[model samples]
Target: MTEFPEGIESGFAAARQIADAVLLEGYVLYPYRASAAKNRLRWQFGVLVPPEYTAQGGEHSHQRTECVMEARQDDRLAVELRFLRVQRRTVERATATGGFEPVERLELADRVLVEWDEAVEERIEILVPVEELMGEGVQQGFRLPGVGETELLREDGTAVGRLVRRREQVDGVVRLKAEELPGPYRAQRLTAVVENASTWIPRRRTPREEALPRALVSAHLLLGLEHGRFLSVTDPPEWARPAVERCRNEQTWPVLAGPDDGCKVILSSPIILEDHPKVAPESLGTLYDATEIDEILALRTAALTDEEKREARGTDARAGAVIDLAESMPPEVLERLHGAIRGLREISAGTPDGEQPWWDPGNDPAVDPERDEVLVDGHAVAAGSRVLLRPGRRRTDAQDLFLAGRTGVVEAVLHDVDGSVHLAVTVEDDPGADLWRAQGRFRYFQPDEVTPLEES
Candidate 1:
């Protein structure tokens, strides 16, 4: 198996910068420090480790993470794991070896100065589910039914312990081989099966080299599915820096982020690297739509909530398209998709000026109208006419600032030299309304975005 690439170059300059920020956000310096807690929370994507695994200083002492991959029937997946190890420590003599060998008052352990030596290792595992590769109900890889025990071994190659099976438990009997997938799976998840992996080993100069085994630090994974490349943060090996950047410049980016669960191991949340450093992912409905997830969400939101409809973002013509397609989807799936969309908004919510040509509404000034007249939803409006305010469909700082369905009466109708019409609305609710800024302290809206109210 091979490693994955550092995915495609970012979509645009803004995207590229954002991608790099996500990668480096929580990353800490080598040997790791304690002052910053955010760095310690980083690199949680695609991590898979055994039950009860926890790191000594950071994540897991003997930890690993994985991605769930499924390739086209014609394609395959290549995997590789890379990391640095504290192989050995060089200890200097802490105390002088004087002629006398007696000293109850002095703690000799303080005399040794320890410096660690580092090394690198790589391991590979390839998986092809029986259901996908072979026919259904065919159990070729599984071992005969029997009880199996997890054995602990010492460096001397001797058994130190075994997890004894209980008298009356359904899962007490462990099979020599892991259970096979039930059947016909498009994607089969596989976790690492580590044996006797530990991060720290006690020094034993009195007898042996060390009392335990360990996993290395700053691990990197290069995984390639039949479709694209996948890799995580962590400085590249000195030899691959230029090559790595070259790869980054050519890669298409999709954010792979997760929650801050405060655990040693976590699964990644798929997102688009967004602007705004301080905003958390939970607030942004800025999820990346690569695998038709947006389509799925469109279908699910067909049944709208009263609150959703009240929010101007939900009233757009696009809302209807997502409904009929989603009626049968489960509520849980819809909830996660809702979270994804909310996360997506966090990016659009900010007011940042950059080379974002892809933005829905250009950041440039509004267009001048051809004629001056005041009309809302095709209804003629004059001073003292009460109406409802509909938020602008275009997502921008000005649009977001407007409240949806607000009740207000036209105080005056004004136009500019360009013949652009503005409705001067005085909202009963806004005591601070001023007739200065377009609609005074209230907001100005094009006649197209407001709903006209007749009498009461």
Candidate 2:
């Protein structure tokens, strides 16, 4: 085990908060009960099964993360790997001979305990100086031994039931290495490979649940720098863009995390996330299902029947906390969850008295969408211009593929507040072109995503 450098913990407070959510992102769903079919099939992201499982075409047995950083030879890098360890909890009833016998469920005076496979969070941290990584690099192996425990259930000194918990052994290795970039800037590329090197071998066609005990669930990495700053692999600078693109990340993507621009910390997750992802302040607590919105889940949790809530409480402690949170939430908190508006600012100066605010285009007299023109392929593409849509490869939406090679008439050439130009066009083949024109609705695209038709 490697000790983290001083101030590492406090410096990564915000990033850790988001990473915690990632660890338990899909641990459970809205219903939050063990019996839920969705809950039964768990650990969707960052699952590293045994090598034997991978050999049989199961999930990969390793995650590789490669990222860049601006650093000096003396700078230090710290890697923290986090994941979940599955623990099987079985309930047993007291036998007539004063012994306990395994059972599916155990009924107590006030509550019921059911057999469930729970998860225990685990983490491993290691630190290394950049100079060392730049030289020979480092490889560290870690192991978590299996554990078993039994708790006797007694009411007023009379035995009723018992709970047995067992955890399987898990082992892995973390390899860290760095290379100095060839550019003029002082930068280095850090490579980390986390592999499940456990000795457990799967039986022929073993089920996922049977192999999960030896697996790493929702595994992710939180990387920090002591005296250097990590670059955004998703949005690197022009000089570093080539290096960023050259970086290879397997089974995970690295993004900026932590407060204020996310330069100090990088969170490598199996689930894709935008740079500087934050846990919304309006969120009351973790629901263990990040796919669903917090408001909807909170409302749905509140609407659960008493029986369902009871089962949820028995399912997991985290689920019980969610139920309690929803039931006791104040009116104001619920209202806050209803909706939220962000990024609004006061209108800037030099606006007409009755004109629309600066947020709207009408406030700027010099800007005219219909009259504006953008140069595309040496031709002015403006209103009434026919062009073939050549959607960019990096277009955000997959539906853009459906519009590939389609023809459209430019309705307006618009400029956003961010200074980016957008061509608003109506599809020539769309039957609702007239209705779209009347409603002032148009599809917008960048200049590079369209080619001028030259009046053909």
Candidate 3:
């Protein structure tokens, strides 16, 4: 373990929220119960298995990240590697001979313990000077020792069962290298490689489940800078574009992190994210799924039956926390998670106070959904335009297959936040067509998913 200066450590902490989200991205899925088939296959990203296992076409054994940064001779770099270590948990029952036998389930007065695998968080930190990395670079090796523990499941003083947990030893190395770019700017390319060097060799044809205990799960890096700033790999400045292009990143990508002030931190993650990614303030806590909607998962967890909730609580401590959090969330907090808007533009110059804001379509004179037009098959399609729905362009939803070749009357042309156009149509023969039109509830399809029926 290594410590960073106060200023540097605080900068690193700014990136911790999103970094932890990536670390435990899919630790558990919705429903949170261990019986769910999706829950059985955990550790979805950044898994570094033993080299021997990966040689047999198993999950990858390492991750590499490379990025460009502007630095000075006196600048210092701090690196932190975070990952999860899988821990095998087993339940045992006491037999007539006073010996404990491994069992799949151990029921007690209050709860039931089931045999399942859990993750234990692990972190390794290193701080080095920029000049040191410019030459021979820095190499740090780490190890997590194997250990086991047992807790007796007792009733009023007599032990009826026992819970045992074990963790396998894992060995790995973090190597950091930096090279000065040949451009006019004082920029350097930094490369970091995380490799799992565990000595446990797998037997021939061994399954991944058996080898997971000795692997480094969900490995990622957090880099902090002192007296210098890191350049954004996703959207670097024009001068640094050439240097960014030369950087080769394997199994992971790097993005600028921390506040919009100088870029003093960079997060190299296995999960892809745009520059300056921030965890939503509305999020209550860790739901173990960052890619999912918080309100939806919270509602689903609250809807689980009592028995299912009990089983989830017994699965792992984190899962139990999730259950408690969802069940006890206040109405105000749940309401906050419903929706949030960002990047609102400042009010236009000299606009009246009672006028609609800039985000509202009515604020713009040229914006009118009903009269907007889109070109499909070399013809302009607008309101009241007859078109044939050919919903096979992308086919994102299964319902699209059933809507193929259906005739529709275009009611509006909608534009999304991403600048893509969509046509809101009402099926020509649908019984609810008039009702849907009146209520403004129309089906939306991309321009490419419809063929215009207008004359040339």
Question: Model 1, residue 74: displacement in angstroms?
Answer: 19
lDDT of 1 by residue, 4-96 (tens): 222311112223223333333223221122122432333332222212233322233333233233334454433333332223322222134
Model 2 lDDT, residue 416, Cα: 81
Tell me the TM-score of each prediction against the true structure.
0.25, 0.77, 0.83
Ranking by lDDT: 3, 2, 1
lDDT of candidates 1 onward, in order = 0.34, 0.87, 0.87
Candidate 3 TM-score versus the reference: 0.83
Model 1 alpha-carbon miss at residue 440, Å? 6.1
Q: TM-score winner among the candidates?
A: 3
| lDDT, candidate 3, 143-261, per-residue tens | 88999999888889988989899999999999999999886788899999999999888899988888899988889999988878899887889999888998898889898887654
Cα displacement (Å) at residue 57, model 1? 27
Give the residue spans of candidate 1 off by over 4 A. Answer: 1-20, 24-269, 273-371, 382-385, 390-405, 410-426, 435-449, 453-456
Select the stronger candidate by TM-score from 2 and 3.
3
Q: What CA root-mean-square deviation does each model show from the true structure?
A: 22.7, 7.0, 4.2
Off by over 4 Å in 3: 55-58, 203-205, 341-389, 393-422, 425-439, 446-456
